[model samples]
Structures are given as C-alpha cells and as structure tokens.
Target: MKIRTRLSLLFTLITAIILLLFATAIYYSAAKDREKEFYSLLKKEAYTKANLFFDADITQKTLQDIYKNNRKILNEVEVAIYDTRSNLLYHDAVDIDMVKETPEMLQSIHEKGEISFYQGDWQVIGVRYPFQNEYYLITATAYDEYGYTKLNNLLNSSILIFILAILVIFFTGIYFSKKTFDPVRDMIKKAKIISASRLDLRLPLKDNKDELAELTNTFNEMLTRLENSFEAQKLFVSNTSHELRTPLTRLLTELELSEKKQLTNDEYASLIHNLTTDVQQLIRLSNSLLDLARANYDRSKITFKTVRIDEILLDARHQVQKLNPQYKVNICFDMETEDDSDISIEGNEYLLQVAFANLFENGCKFSDNLQSQVVITNKEKKIQLTFSDSGIGISEKDLKKIFDPFFRGDNKYFTEGNGIGLSLTKKIIEIHNGSITAQSELNHGTTFIIELPI
Candidate 1:
C-alpha cells in the first residue's frame, strides 16, 4: 500500500479505538450513577413506609395506597421489611416471596449497616432499620427503565459518532498526505521530461525552508554537476579527436605516397626518416593522450601510500634532467622540521612524480636560460612546493586556459609538445586531493605553486 493509504487507515483505526474507550467509560459512569440514584429513591420509600406503619399508627393498606399513588411510574420499586426473627412484617409486591431474606442476608445488613447489589435487572439495597428497641431489616429493589433507555440511546449515538469520526479521520489523513507529497509528485513530473539534452532544466524550489524544499535544491545541484561533467566530456572528446586526426592523416598520406612510386636510395632514406619522425610524433601524442585519460579516470584505480613530496620532487627533477641534460633543475627543503614525515603526503607516487615532472619540464622549456628554481616548505599538516623559472611567461588571456586540454600559449608556437602535460598534471594533483596554481607575467617569469596535505 502507498504511505498515504497506510497513514489514513492507521489514523482511522487509532481514532476508532479512542472513541470506543471514551464511549465505554461514559456509558459505565452513567449506568453506575443511575443505579445509585435509583437505590437512594428506593431507600427513601422504604423509610417512609416504616414511619407510616409503625410510628404514625397508619394501616398497611392506606400506606400501600399512598405509595402506589405517589411513586414514580417508571421506578418499579419494591419494598420488604422483616423482624429480627426473619418473619416478614411488610411487603408491597406480589412477588415478595421470590426475594427471600435469609438469616445470612439480614445478619450481613445488620453487620455492615447497609448493603447494595444487583439482582438481574433489579438493583437491591438492604439496610438495618431499628424501631422501638426492635431490630428490623428493610430491602428495596428497582429497575431504572428511563436511565437504561437513555443509556441505549447514548450507545447507539456513540457508535454512530465513532463511525463518522473514523471516516473523517480517514479522508482527512489522505487529503493531508497528498498535499504534503505534492512537491514530490511535481518533481517526478518535471524529472521525466529532463534528458541529457535538457540538462539546463531545473526543478523549482518552494522556499518553504522544509525538507521538500531541501530535496528540490539538492536535485537541482546534482543536475548542474551532471551538466558540467557532460560538457567537459564532450570537450575532451572533441580535442582528442582533432589532436589524433592531424598525425593520423599525415601518416596515411605519406604511406600512400611511398607506395605509389619507387625512389632513389637517398630520397628513400630521407622519406623513411621523415615518416619515422611523424610516427614518433604520433607515438608521443598517443602517450600524452593516455596519460591525460589515466589522470582523469576514477581515483579507485590508483594505489595510495604515504610518500614524501620532497622526495617525489627530487625524483621528477632527476627524470627531467636526464631527458634534457642542458636544463638546470634544483631542489631544496625550506623548513625547520627535522622529522622527514612532516613533509609526507598520501598519494600515488608515480602519478605525483609525473605531475611534478610536467611542471619542472614546463619551467625549463619556457625559460630563456633553460634553468629553474625549486623551493619546498613544510608546515602544520601541509607542504608547499614552488617551481619558478625565467621563462617566456604566459599572457593574461592564455594563462586562464593554460591547463585546458590541448591549449598552448601563442608565444610557444615553436615548442615541441602536444599541450596535454599541464592538463594531465592538474588532473593528477586534483585526484590526490591537492591544488596547483600559477603566477606569471609576460617576459618576466612564471611560478607554479603546489599545496598538499600531509
């Protein structure tokens, strides 16, 4: 069942139970009070009869006539009196023998002073009556016909009210439940029309400062993130396709030309060398593309361990120096801490090394003197590494997009690169939960700063 239906049924069931308990309590109290009142009236009638017969010197026939004339018609009261010897002295009913007063019954009334109990539909009250130094027992019984009729009517009315209350509670519960979940229904309807092409569509917020509004805002944020990711993926694919097509097209054209003619030895050797250069460029581009992809892939694929950022920088420096011996790469630790672990951070060692290598190579490649300076500082739970060089610094417009895939500054047109190094480096740093930033001015120098938590 739906939650709304369940809630409605539960509400109705609980209301019914409460109404039943209330009706039962009211009916019981009314019945008890009516019985007490009837018993009081019956006791008064018994006392009046005793006074008339014994104290007033009135005959039993005249007293019976007065009782029959003055008694309430609905209060079918009957009275009996007995002496201490259990001999009946007075009775006003034809069935007085049916209500036998045993010696135990009279002794009970004498001992307790007064007693009352139910005898089928009749309520009986017995009392000790003493007159002229003689002990007597008086018993009265009556049926509350009017009170019972009121009780039956109350019972029928209560049942009707209970049923009506249950129905009201059920429908009210359903109406409120639907009204409460109306936002969810609207969200579902809006979400159905949204596809990848319609990512710009956003769910409306109620601004009610409630959970439903919170849910709507959260879904809108998720859609925004998904849209950004989709756009980035599209851009990455487009750039990769363009970068790969250039080299592939060259390779195919050169191979087709070579197959069309047989040439002299020198010409053939030159053609082979040119083709080899293009093939090497393709290889480099392919490797760079793979690195970019690996850097941006799911972080779960990368293994993590505690690694010293200083040591990783040293390793990257050595690798860069080996690849370009003419370029100068220097490193230093610029912190007061003697503990080596202070400079340590958790990350994939190889990926960190690759990121630092790209930054170092970029510094060396762009500098006029092919020289770069490296500084490392360790602080509380963080390490700051800076790479500075006297290079052809980036322009303001190009610097903003320097880390974008396949983006190269205008001044670096002659540089031999696929332009994915900085992009891959950025992705790797981000994957390690670190940040990289750059400060540069055209023709002055460039500096790359990296921050990582230990």
Candidate 2:
C-alpha cells in the first residue's frame, strides 16, 4: 500500500479502538447509575408502604389509595409487607402476590436491614422496619422502562458518533501526510529533468530548517562535485590530445622528410637523435598521465604503511639523477633531532616518491644552476619539507596557474618540460593527506613547501 493510505488506515484503526473503549465505558457507567437510581426508588417505596401500614392515624383504605397512586409512577412495581412471623400483612396487587413471603427472606431482611437484588427483569429492594416493639419486612420490585430507553438511545448515538469520528481522523491523516511529503514529490519532479547535459540545474531549497531542507542541500553539494568532475575530465582529455599530438606530429614529419631525401650519415644520425628526443618526450608524458590517474583513485583501496619522508626524498633524488645525471639534488636536515618516528608518515610510499620526484625535477628544470635544495623539518606533530631552487623565477600570474595540468608559464617557453609534474605532484600529496604550495618571484627563484601529518 502507499504510505498515505497505510497511514490513514492505521490512524483510523487506532482512533476507532479508542472510541469503542470510551463509548463502552460511558454506556456501562450510565447503565450502572440507572440501575442504582431504580433500586433507590424501590427501596423508598418499600419503606413508605411499611410506615403507612403501621400508622395508627391512617386507615387501611387510605393506605391502599396512597399505594395505588404511587404505583402508577413506577413500571411493573410490586410491594409486599410481612410481620416477624412471616405472615403477609399487605400486598400491593389485589388478586395475586407478586413476591413470595418466606421465613428465610424475612429473617434475612431483619438481619441486613435492607437489601437490593434482581428478580428476572425487575429490581427488588427489601427493607426491615420497626413499629411499636416489633419488626416488619417490606419488599418492593420494579422494572425501569424510562431508564432502559434512555440507555439504549445513548448507546446508538455513541456508535454513530464513533463511526463519524473515525472517518474524520482517516481523511485528516491523509491530508497531513500528503502535505508532509509534498517537498519530496517536488524534488523527484525536478530531479527527473536533470541529466548530464543539465548538471548545472539544482533543486530549490525552502526557508525552513528541517530534514527535507537538509536533504536538498546535500543533493546540491553532490551535484556541484559531479559538475566539477565532469569539467575536469573534459579539460584533461583536451589537454592530453594536444600534448600527445605535438610529439607524434614532430616524429611523423621527421620520418617523412628523411624518406623524401637522400641524406649523409651525419644527417641520418641527427634525424635519429631528434626522433629519439620526441619519443622520450612522449614516454614521459604517458607516464605522468598514468601517475596522475592513479593518484585520483579512492584512498580506502590503497595500501598505506609508515614510511619515512626523508627516505622518499632520497629515493626521488636518486631517480632524478639516474635519468638526468647533470641534475643535482642536495638534501638537508634543519631540525634539532633526527627521530625516525618524527619523519615517518602513513602513506603509499610509491606515490609519495612520485610527488617528491616531480618537485625535485621542477625545481632543477627551471633553475640556471641545474640544482635544487630540499630541507626537512619536524614541527607541531607534522613533517615539513621545502624544495628551493634559484631559477629564472616565475611571474605572479604564471605562479597561480603552475599547478594546473599542462600549464606552462610564458617565461619558461624555452624549457623542454611538460607541465604535468606539479599538477601530478599536488594530487599525490593530497592523496596522502598532505598539502603543497609554491612561492616565487621574478628572477628570485621558487620555493615549494609541503606539510604531512606524521
């Protein structure tokens, strides 16, 4: 069943049960009150008859007349009077005795003074009366027609009201439940209209601070991340195609030119050297792209271990020097104590090495001295490393876009390097829960600072 219908039914069922119990209680209480009132009237009639029978001023005819007049007030009312010896003295009916006078009954009435009970449908009350030095027993019985009629009418009315109340509660539940889920319905409608081409669209937020509003906010935040990721993917594909096409085009042109002309050994060797350089450039670009893609993997799936930051730097330096022997990397310690734990951090060792290698290469590639200096420090429960190089520094405008993939500064056009290094380096550092930032000035060189939790 739909939520609205289920809620409505549940609401009606609960209200109906409560109404049933309440109506039953009211009817039972009213029936009890009516029975008590009828019994009271019977007891009063019995006492009056006994008193009048023993009165010396009232004659027998006058007593009968008084009883006949009062009997008309009660329905099916019967009165009987008896002496201590169980002899019937006065009977309300002329031709028959409605109540049987027994010795045990008179004895009971004398002992208890008064008692009330039911005889068939009649309410009976027996009373013990005292006249001059003698006790008499008097019993009266009556059927309360008016009381029963009123009780029956009340029961029927209560049933009718109970059914009406249940109906009201059922519809009221449906109305309120629909009102409550109206926002969710609107969200579903809006979401249906949003596709990849329309990622900029967002769900409208209400002014209230409720659960539905929080849900809308969370969805909007997710949409923002998805839009950013899509844009980044498009940019990455565009940049990759452009970077790859340059080296491939150069290689193709070189091969075409050599095939078209008869060249000397020196020309062939120079052409071969140029082709090798282009091939190497392509290989490096491909490796950098792979590293960048790997860095974007989910962190939870990656295995991390406690690896020393300084060791990663040393390994990166060795790798850089092995590839380009002319490049010089100097590592320095600026802290007071060289504690192993202080320099150790939880991270994927290979990714950390890649990040450091990129930074080292970047520092040396831009510097005139073909060298970079890396200083390590342990402070505030974190490992801080600074890579400094005395290069023909970056302009302020270029520095801002340095970490953007394939973004080379206008001043560094003469350098033979792809701009993937810094961007890949930043992604790797972030994967290890670390941060890297660069500071540079024109002709004053650049310094990259990295901080990682230990």
Top-TM-score candidate index: 1
- TM per candidate: 0.83, 0.79
**Listing every candidate in turn, what is its Cα RMSD in Å to the true structure after a full C-alpha superposition?**
3.6, 4.4
User: Residue-wise lDDT of candidate 1 within 293-363, one digit each (tens)?
Assistant: 78877899888999978788889989989878998988977887778788888899988888888888888
- C-alpha lDDT score of every prediction, in listed order: 0.84, 0.87
State the weakest 10-residue window (summed lDDT) of model 2.
93-102
Q: For model 2, which pairs clash?
A: none
Candidate 1 Cα deviation (angstroms), residue 377: 1.3
Q: Per-residue CA lDDT of candidate 2, range 1-454, in tens?
A: 9877898898889889988999999999999999999988888877777766677577767776766787677565678888878887888775645556578877999899988888777788889888888888888887788999999999999988988888888889999989988898999999999999999999999998999999999999999999999988999999999999999999999999999999999999999999999999999999999998998899998899999888888999999999989999999999876468988999998999999998888888888898999999887998899999998888899989998988888765758777888999998889888899999988888999999998
